[model samples]
Target: MHINFPLILVIAVAVAGLLALLDLVWLAPRRRRVIAAYQAQVDTPDPQTLERLDKEPLLVEYGKSFFPVLAVVLILRSFLVEPFQIPSGSMKPTLEVGDFILVNKFAYGIRLPVVDTKVFDVGDPQRGDVMVFRYPNEPRINYIKRVIGLPGDHIRYADKQLYVNGEPVPRDLMRTEPDDEVPPGHPLQSLAKVDIYEEYLEDSAHLIRHKRLSQPARPQEWLVPEGHYFMIGDNRDNSNDSRYWQSDQMPRELWGMVPDNYIVGKAFAVWMHWPEPKLSNLPSFSSISLIH
Candidate 1:
């Protein structure tokens, strides 16, 4: 299962913020009074001296630390584009499994955190543009794919080719990038992954690897419903996108219909790489754990 990083960040921040607020409201004032009262008892040292329990000041210290950190993280993740590491080769070539990518959080405009309600106007996903968005099925999950179908357009996939608005999305084969698999009896051959064949996703396109000659073979047609989009991966045959699961609905609340508010941003470049050094070098969450 995909790790819900954003949700985790949100929850951690929110809980810390709540605790901080509670201390300010209920505990801070009480601690002051209790401390003052204990001082009074110390001064008197009468026969019926009352001893107060020690409040370790734990909540105050933690609130001071965690609350600020969480708040900053919340604001950054919500307003600015957040960095993400590709855990799979779903976006191979353009984005390898280990590439660290930055999402344009404000590209689609700023939105409230948690609720994810967009309150400003920014921009829309253009044809052939790569986008990262909250997976509608689960907003807690983020899925990166190229935006193929916009609202009110016809999109189809058959024989590993994309059909948009009754026209085939064209691809001009460039050259096959070297496959990463090392020849047998050589060194560790796990890094054999390579950008198979380069193809223009249209006029404005990106490079991708198909692993083999076979691409996606879904023969289906779809009308890009209003407020919805048709998404597909540059690695056609291997993508589970609108064609396979059918076009997804992009409603604002579901975060599935990826309202502009849910737009994370465009990925620009790679930042790091790490081969699994196991049977397969493609990085996984477990690999990221090892990285940690």
Candidate 2:
């Protein structure tokens, strides 16, 4: 089952805050008064009264210490920055499986947690920016991809080439051999051809992988809708992105553009890349580097 972590955090904060308030406003004062009255009646307090005076309530102690920390985490992650891991090769070369990346939450704007309603507008996503967003098909699941088409822009993918606004994007071939570093049993391992290229986007350039053995989806063009964006994975043939959406397999909600409110953040850096269990002995930092 999918656990809703944000909701859990919110609940934790509320419960902790309530326990702390109860102790501060009523329980602690009442206990102190009772202990003081018992002390006045005898030269030395009884074992029961002494125990009560010395022992701190577990709930109240924990609440008072943990609430502030949890509140700070919630605010920072929701507004400033958040971290994510790449689990697939959809953005290979630029991002790889096992890479832990930090996303700039305020780059696009600040949004309330859980509800994801954008409350501020710092900036809009630019072309070539790597982004994390709620999957259009499932709002609860997050996906990462590069922004290819902005609102009102036209995008076309054909013959393994990308076109934006009637201009063809440029690319330089980097390699043709299958990447030996690809994890064993990975889907890319069985592919006959793996081509890597440095594709130049409107503003920046990044590496992309192409699988020659896989059949290309028919060329398609899309006109991005207002307040929405078009995205595509860097691994062109292997990724199930905006290029191919079958009505039978996907809900109508994923027809084309991703709603603006669905954006999570802009992914900017790769902080770590631990070795996968399948290749534990291999160099863990083979793919460790800053993301473009």
Candidate 3:
């Protein structure tokens, strides 16, 4: 099960902030009074008065010191930028497994952290933008995909080709190369005969993978509704996207166009990448670069 980290952070901040406020309003004044009283009777202070002046609850001390730091982190993560690690190859050439990316939280406008209510009119996501959002099927889990269709767009995917508003998106084949076996430990290791193509979406060109022998399933055409978007993965055949999510196994929540409010952030850059099972000769800075 996915953990609701944002909700947890919100709850933590509220609790800590409350404790800190209480300490400032009530506890601190009480402590000061006890200290003043003891000081006034310093020459012959009673044991009870001295004890009251010296002792402090550990919880109060922690709340005073930690609450400010937590509040700052909450503000930064919720509105400025947040870091995320890529866990799957759905975005492959654009984003890879183990790549740590920074998402621009305010790029699509600022939103309340846990509830995700957008409060500012920053900007809308354009076609070809890579976005991270809560998975519709499971709201707690996050998913990343490229926006292919904006509001009022007629999107079609047939025979592994894309069409927008009845015009075929230009795809210049850079080259066709032999496919690679799905690496060990991959979920789709059973898939075979994969081919790679360098396809361009508008001026932003990127690589995509497809299975040569397998026919594209369920040719689809969708008229994107207002305030909703159509998204797809760069790994066309291997991805579970808006075009191929009507399975009975998938919950109804996971189906249909993604709402604008569901967007989390625009994925801007890859800050770092580290391959698993660390190798000695691995190029340290090979994957350290800006994301397309």
Best by TM-score: 2
- TM-scores of all predicted structures: 0.68, 0.87, 0.86
Candidate 3 structure lDDT: 0.81
The TM-score of predicted model 1 comes to 0.68
* lDDT tens readout by residue for model 2, 40-109: 8899768976896856688789999999999998888889988887888788768878788899999988
Candidate 3 per-residue C-alpha lDDT over 44-111 given as tens digits, one digit per residue, 9 for 90 to 100:
77878677676667887777788888889899899998999888888876787788889999999989
Cα distance off (Å), candidate 1, residue 66: 1.9
What's the C-alpha lDDT at position 242 in model 2?
76
> By descending TM-score, how would the candidates be arranged?
2, 3, 1
Question: Which model scores highest in lDDT?
Answer: 2
What global local distance difference test value does model 1 have?
0.65
Off by over 4 Å in 3: 44-55, 175-178, 181-194, 246-254, 275-285
Which residue pairs of candidate 3 clash? none
Q: What 10-residue stretch in candidate 2 is worst by lDDT? A: 246-255
Model 2 stretches with alpha carbons more than 4 Å out: 43-51, 179-191, 246-254, 275-288
